[model samples]
Target: MSALELVLLLVLVTDPFGNLPLVLAALGRLDAAAYRRAVVRESLFAFGVLLVLGWGGAGLLQAFGITQPALYIGGGVILFLLSLRMIYGNAQGAFDDGYAADPLLVPIAVPAIAGPAAIATVILLRTQQAVPLSQLVLGLLCALLITLATFLPGRRIAAWLGPRGVNAMEKLTGLLLNLIAVNMMLEGVRRFLG
Candidate 1:
């Protein structure tokens, strides 16, 4: 796929809107400066992780003989579940004690931001082959940057949306994720059949 496609796909799978609630909860206790710092740190850290994975991911997966469809389905399932669980309150244990107090880096950093889905998408981007490595890096970085910018202002955005608006957007994004899950399953079936 093209660099633009890769970036957009990453953005969709990452789903900053899904993160708004998390941001609001985590930052509820922090002061303004700390909130901003945490936002920048978590997003940048997540970006760095994805950048490394995007650069070397294809070779690692190829070495393991993992097929593209396998990655897609597996990653999508994990992501879909993550979204589903969060939406349905089935993912309450994503953090341990003290997490609620300082979750800016732990749960938010590792999974909420970088996330399994984004990591898998980076690997899939590697298999595209037509795209140059530099372009791939650029795409991933661009998407991550977008995530950083988007997520930083999430609290404000959430406020503007109000509870009703936020819930509406959350459900809409959830529906989108459900579609992504079905697409991933279909891709896996197609590849297996082929």
Candidate 2:
């Protein structure tokens, strides 16, 4: 894949737009300054987690003797399921509002930004795609930056887009993700057969 494609894929998996509602809900109680601080902090934390996973994922897979084909298939399945959820389910309703007034890093950082789908995508990009580590890291950084940019003004963006607009955008992203997932699966099947 080209560098742009890699970055786009990373952005899609990170899915800042799709996760906006969750982030807003999680950080709703905080004041303006606290909200900005939490968003930046949690985003940084997520970046660190994903960076580690991207660097070590291949070694971890090799340790387990997991093949590329398996990773491709498994990752594709996971992405497909996540896309389905994005398309059909209520993103906000999926999680509970049980967070404290000043949330730290549970929902917003881990699962919201660097969730399983995002983690899987990073691993796949590191292992399955032939992109160099440097390029992958750069792409990851760019994607995260884009995510952070979206999140910084999330409330206003959400307001402008409104509920229906946000939902439509999420569904559109989900549709694109579904295509990518299928292609990944196909590539895996071809590699296995060959």
TM, every model: 0.83, 0.95
Assess each prediction's global lDDT (C-alpha) against the native: 0.72, 0.86
TM-score of candidate 2 against the unseen true structure: 0.95
lDDT of 2: 0.86
Poorest stretch of ten by lDDT in candidate 1? 89-98
lDDT tens readout by residue for model 1, 56-164: 8888888999887788778778767766755664222454345665564567767876788778767766664446668877876787678777667777887888877
- Write one digit per residue (lDDT tens) for candidate 2, span 16-100: 8888888888888888899899899998988788889999988989899989888888888988988898999867776676888
